[model samples]
Target: MVINFGAGPAKLPREVLLEVQKELVEYGSSGMSVMEMSHRGTTYVKLHEETLELARELLKVPDNYKILLMQGGGTGLFAAVAMNLIGRTGSADYLVTGSWSAKAAKEAAKFGKVNQVVPKPAKYTCVPDPKSWKLDPKASYLYYCDNETIEGVEFNFVPETNGVPLVVDMSSNIMSRPVDIKKFGVIFACAQKNIGPSGITLVIVREDLIGHQLPTTPTILDFSIVAKDNSINNTPPTFIIAVVGRVFAWIKRQGGLQKLYQDSLTKSNMIYAVVDGSKSFYYCPLEANVRSRMNVPFRIGGPSGNETLEKEFLKGAEQLGMQQLKGHRSVGGIRASLYNAVTIEEAESLRKYMLEFLAKNS
Candidate 1:
């Protein structure tokens, strides 16, 4: 059995896939695949409503929050957040923890002023201390990425935004753990990581923040317009949303977010233990506290890393039916993305491989 560890478009639960296979061609006697069904038709509409309701139920999203299904990945919502809320005070505060947040701040700059709460660091390793952040109380919103997939860094705690609405890009970490739905004004995630596929983006925003888009904001990017139509303003990604619904159902069956969070802790710890115990053989760059539970990035052959051994590592993993252990190109190393669907057995197998590689190479 092949265990996939790629970051996005990562492994989905096997049972969910099997369920999809069983219903792919004819969803509940519709006589057409979900892909072939019209998004606005009765069948797909019911599916869509159920998906949204499932999401709200699982996330414990408050009545005040509206969960919107939209296109344009996480990057698209970067602009959407600025377009929708930056007009409130004509500026936004951003906590630049890693590549994704840095990109978000840059994008928000086009629509309004961007106040980087802290200067961008030379290397993306850990989150800067919140005490050191210079936040603006008058800013429309404070933005940050909950987990940086590429750097393997995560915010262990939410930053106190000093009453400024907190806007977060949780693309890589959403649904992996429980979150306080009321802590922020907006929480957006792309479906590719932990939720479903690549075509849909989920935005959870406070109903109060729905309107008030910038005058120049496109109708599609306008959160108010999308929310007004129940995310059916234009053609929605029917198949992707359907798959996301299945995944949400799978989460509920697996005991919801708390269970997934516990599983995440166990799976990541299994691999992290191997890396930490390897002496100089393996090294993870981030601090112990801020290291990501979803994605673990480590270098082999000391902290500077040995590219030769890294290549050998990937080859041996592939031979054992494990793949995508390679890190991001910008940061060369081995990365095991312990997403919700990557089973404990898969993580333990990776841990075993790491130890075996260490023994043979050392």
Candidate 2:
């Protein structure tokens, strides 16, 4: 009965949780939990391979791409990407649209030169026009994050980079919407947010981008090595991969990316309507054209009013089985993360509660 709105490690599908519960003691007749199995064991290997294949199918990933299941989260991939792709020249163009993209640019700076393309208005309100970007033709790759979880800004259009390879960090909004994987050379996401669990990170890189790691890069951190070995270079996160496989099956059963995209749009529109209908009582700072469909952040009023409002909302919602409605500590506003697991009914419940709360407070 509880509703969870935390960003990462967020709520999972009820059927997925139930399936996990049923298999917690015996997995596929193996008489052991997926976590108890050795990563190198045949059962685990099958699970891993099937999981990767299902994910590729769900995303409709191109044949030229290799999906890798790696250990580090999105943060690790940021450094690994710079190390591997930003060669001796060590220069790349970065689009700074949100906190995550800014962090990626900062991490890339440690390895080489990074030209950060700052969007105008000095904040992440909307995506900068592609024509305005001062991109370096000699740069390794252009890096961006598709959605900023904290800021609630999302890129509605892909940048046309001529021949430059586009790399994206899709950590918080990977499976929430449909994306053309062929348009990018690399797309990496931490699995905890949308896929399944926290231990595994998914990287989909074009086969051509694989073998270019700098000599200083660790072998384990190299995408070429991981891709070549089918992500079995070392002990994989077997339990997480198993759960991700379940998620993939669930997505497939729910009718693939197109259906997911529709569901996300519907849920997002529903919530936005409620926020917009609140008039001055609710304030969403992000530009409407670039608002995120996955993470909706808003404030009730000024600092004091926002604090009191958030407290009352959280207290009342928690009593009614809604949880994790608090915003990010850095932002100090409300953030309601609507992952794939959150149903339309739950969203409506939240909207109903908000309407009632505003009526009482205002």
Candidate 3:
């Protein structure tokens, strides 16, 4: 069976998929698929509430924070967050570390003044030092993307906001690791990577930050309405949310987020070891301090691009039942996304293939 390494909509736990299939035909004698159930139906309501409660419990979110299960991916929140929070101050500060954060800052600019600490496009290797940050004390919120999937860069520590509310987009790395919930004003992640599947978005926002929209924000995008109504303002992604609830249950059963984080560390360490030992045959671009544990991007062969050999490596990997190993189009090479569901054995298989490919090419 080919393993998936795609960044978002990545591989899922086998048990979860199998379980979902069993429920797909008719959910526990409710006589309808979750997709067919009404949003007002009791069966769907229980399913939704359980999932939301599980997320709140698993994340150990502060009581002051409200966890809203809403529609829209992280990209949607980029606009929503700007409209909701920018009302307080007409400006916001953004720490642009990689592609995602840079994009978020650009979207935020449409609603308010954006202070991008980094004036130029980021190199997408190492994270900029906090000491180098030019934060605006008067800004409404300090925004950052916790991990950049395409660039394979992740932050090692939380930034000190000095009472300035902080918002983090944790789409790529949420649930793979434990986070200090008290650190940020908002923690939002879409359910495509570590959670379950695409179409559902999870937002954990401090209750105090909920109701400050500029009156023009869409009712659906308004944090107060979404939070108060329990995220069913619209029809909601019922089927996807059901799948996410199962994923959350699986995580809790698998010894919680701490255990999953250790697995991620082990998986990433194995891959990095192969690259580091290859002696320039395989090299990672990101700096030592900020290498991501969820996504590892590396280039094969020497500098100046080895597109042909990289193609061969990907072909060989596919032949060996590994697919989605090709790097993103923007930065081509290889990207192995070790989301919570990606197995260690799969990573080891890729490592072995890499070593074999290098030996043959050399």
Candidate 4:
């Protein structure tokens, strides 16, 4: 079987896929596929409510939080967050650690003043020290991306925002680890990475943070409307939501977040061991402490990354039944995305190939 390591639209647990397959045509005696069921109908409504419930149970989302199942991906939330919350203070603070956070800050600038906690760095290898952050006490919210898939940087700890509302984009690492949901005012994730499919974007907003949107905010983008209507303001992503429910059920079956978090560390450590032990053959750009457990970006030929050798490595990886091992085009190298669905056996296979390649080429 080919091991998939794409960053987004990544792998789903085989068991979840199998379960989805069984219900793809006709779902649980509803006499119609989930895709054909109306969002208002009992069948789809139950599926929607159950999916949200499973999400709440798995994440331990508090009763005060409203989990909305919406259509836009992470990019849409870049603007949606600003429109909704920036109205509170007419500005927001952003910690720009990597590409995604940088984009979010830029989008927020269109709506209000954006005070980047730290200046953009020459490269996205490490997060700036929190002590050096220039936080605006009057800012509407403090926004940060918990994990940056392309740059392979993840925050080791949550940033303290004093009393300010803390908003996080956990798109790439949402369910891979345990999180304290109460610490943040809003947590949004695109489902394709660790959850399920691409069409759904899960937004969990604290109750009070709902309804504070800019006057011009679109009805659909307003968190209050989405939450008040129970994320049924329009035709929701029914099929994607169903598949996400299956994935959550799969997660629950696997001993929940703690188990998956341990599995994540194991899977990531296996590959990082090869990279670190390779001496000079392989190099990871991010700092050791901030290295992402979900997406690992590394270079094949030294620190600057020799493109030719990196291309050769990917070619060999593909030949060995590994696919999507190539890094993002913007930063050419190798990236192994160890999302929740990527098994430890697949990680071991990649580790073995890296060692073999090192021995042959060194």
Candidate 5:
């Protein structure tokens, strides 16, 4: 059993992949492969609608929200959301907790004014105290990332938007836990980490937020056009969408989001315990309250230890058939992404490896 722990383009459950492999040749009596089928064809269209319907029911997304399948990843939505929503007020409020949110705020600024709400030090170690946030009453929406894949930090609490729409980039954390859809105006995720492969994106937007986009916004980026077209404005990533649909079904069979969340907590706990017990041998920078349950990045030989040791750890892990333990390029260390597909057994195995490595290096 090969284990993959890369962040995004991460692992899908073996069952899902195996079934997909079978259907890849010929998708369920349709004779032609999904690749050969037209996007407008009945077989592909049914899969498209099924994907949206499953997403709605599993996520418990409300009837008022219009589920849109976007083409670009979460980064695309960074600009798409800004152009579509910032038209009303000409500005938006951004809570810069980590890299993605900061990037979102920077991208949004290209369209209009961006009001930043952050604390001193501008660190990604933990969530800024919401009480200290300087929310702009006239802003178009309040935007934040639910989880930071690079820094391994996650927001423990939702923001109180007052009267503004709460726009979220849930790329790394969506579907990993239970979330109330009624609180937000827009919630989007790139289908890579937790959902499926890259190429397809999911955007759940409130019906009222559909139209009224900036005149300068591109036709495809315009949520109004994309929504009306039912996300098939172009060919759409039919193959990837088919894979994502199966993943959604896999999550449902695993007892839905609640069980997935518990599995997440359990898996992360295994690795966290190893980090905490290693006495100074291993280190996780984020505070306990905000540590990510999905992406857990920890140093190989504590804070003061030589960074050179990380390479040795990676080599050892690779020798043992483990892969993609390296952290983000910006934050160099190790990050084990425990997405829904990564099992608790793999996490426990990693923890065991951590202890063994610590003992040898120490």
Candidate 6:
């Protein structure tokens, strides 16, 4: 009855959760829980291999790309990427469109110099023009966040970096839609938001970018070491990985990336239409072209309002079993995270509730 809208550690598919529950006590007749299995044991090893293969197949990842199931969350990658790639070059280009990307840039600066290419004031509502980005030829990689969870801004089109390797933090919108794996050199995401639970991280890196870690990079943080060892340099988050494997199986059975893309579009469109049709009762401040399908941020008042509207919205939603509609603290507005697990029906129900609330409160 609960609708979870927290960005990370968000809601999971019911089937996946059920499967995890069933296997919690006995995993494939191993007579032990998945968490109790030794990472180096054959059973765990097989599970690990199969999960990686499934992820690659689901994403249509090319053979040249190595999928590493590593530890550390999306934030860890922000530093790992800089340490591994921004070594001798001592510089990288970053596109700052939202909170996550800005954080990535800040982390990168700790390793070396970062050239921030922010969106123009006029085009803040849209993706920055790739041609306008001041790319340093000596830079190692260009980093960006595919979707900003807090700001509700997304990049509808891929940015062309003129041959510079593209590194993206897809934590908030990883498997919500289809993506061309060949378009980027490395794509990393924390599994909690869309794939599975909070402990495991997914990293898809082009083979060429695996090595070249700086001397200061920790052994566990080095992508080359992790990729070379097949992400077994140390114990992994076995339970989370197993759960993610089940989620991947569910995604494949539900119709793969194309179906997910269509579902996301339909669900997002349904809610957005309601907001747009609400006239001045609701306000979506994000630029139209860059609106995110995974996270929708909206305000109840036209231009200005206090916390009254938000408080009422949460109270009314909770009363109707529609939970977690509060916005992020950094951005004081309503945010509904419609990840892969969220059905169109739930979104519609929320839309209906919003309309009713407006009618009563407006």
The prediction achieving the highest lDDT against the true structure is 4
Q: Predictions ranked by lDDT, top down?
A: 4, 1, 5, 3, 6, 2
State the lDDT of candidate 4 residue by residue for 1-362, as single tens digits.
Answer: 79999998999999999988998999999988999989899889998999999999999999999999877799889989999999998989999988999999999999999998898788999988889999999999999999999999999999999999999999999998999998999999999999999998999999999888999998878999999899999988889999999999999999999999999999999999999999978999889999999999999889889888888888988898899999898887899999999999999999999999999988
Clashes of each: 0, 0, 0, 0, 0, 0
Q: Write the per-residue lDDT of candidate 6 for residues 252-284, one digit (tens) a residue.
A: 998997898899898888788878988867888
Which of the predicted structures, 3 or 6, would earn the higher lDDT when compared with the native? 3
* Residue lDDT tens for model 1, 307-334: 8998989999999999888999988899
What lDDT does model 6 reach? 0.86
Residue 227, candidate 6: Cα error in Å is: 0.7
Question: How close to the true structure is residue 327 of candidate 4, measured as C-alpha lDDT?
Answer: 87
CA shift of 143, model 3, Å: 0.3
Q: What is the lDDT of residue 262 in candidate 2?
A: 88
Off by over 4 Å in 6: 119-125
lDDT of each: 0.92, 0.86, 0.89, 0.93, 0.90, 0.86
Tens-place lDDT per residue, model 3, 50-102, is 99899988899878999988777988999989999988889999998888898
What's model 2's overall lDDT?
0.86
Model 2: lDDT of residue 327:
82
Cα misplacement distance, residue 150 of candidate 3 (Å): 0.8
Candidate 3's displacement at residue 133, Å, is: 0.7
Per-residue lDDT of model 5, residues 1-362, tens digit only: 56799998888889999999999989999998888899999999999999999999999999888898888798899999999999889999999878888889999999999999875354579887778889999999999999999998898888998889999999998999999999999999999999999998899999998886999999888988888888888889889999999999999999999999999999999999988998878988889999999999888776644578999999888887788999888888899999999999898889888989988988
Please provide TM-scores, in order, for all candidate models, with all chains considered together. 0.99, 0.97, 0.98, 0.99, 0.98, 0.97
Question: Candidate 2 at residue 63, lDDT?
Answer: 96
Model 3 CA deviation exceeding 4 Å by range: none
lDDT of 2 by residue, 1-362 (tens): 89988898898888998999999888988889998998888888889889999989888899999999988798899998898898835699999888898889999998889998764355567888777889888888999999898888989998887778899999888887778999999999998778897988899998887777888888778998998899999988787788889998998898887888888888888878877887768778878999898999888874324787788788998999998878888777788999888888898888888889879887
After superposition on all CA atoms, what RMSD does each candidate show versus the true structure?
0.8, 1.5, 1.0, 0.7, 1.1, 1.6
TM-score of model number 4 = 0.99
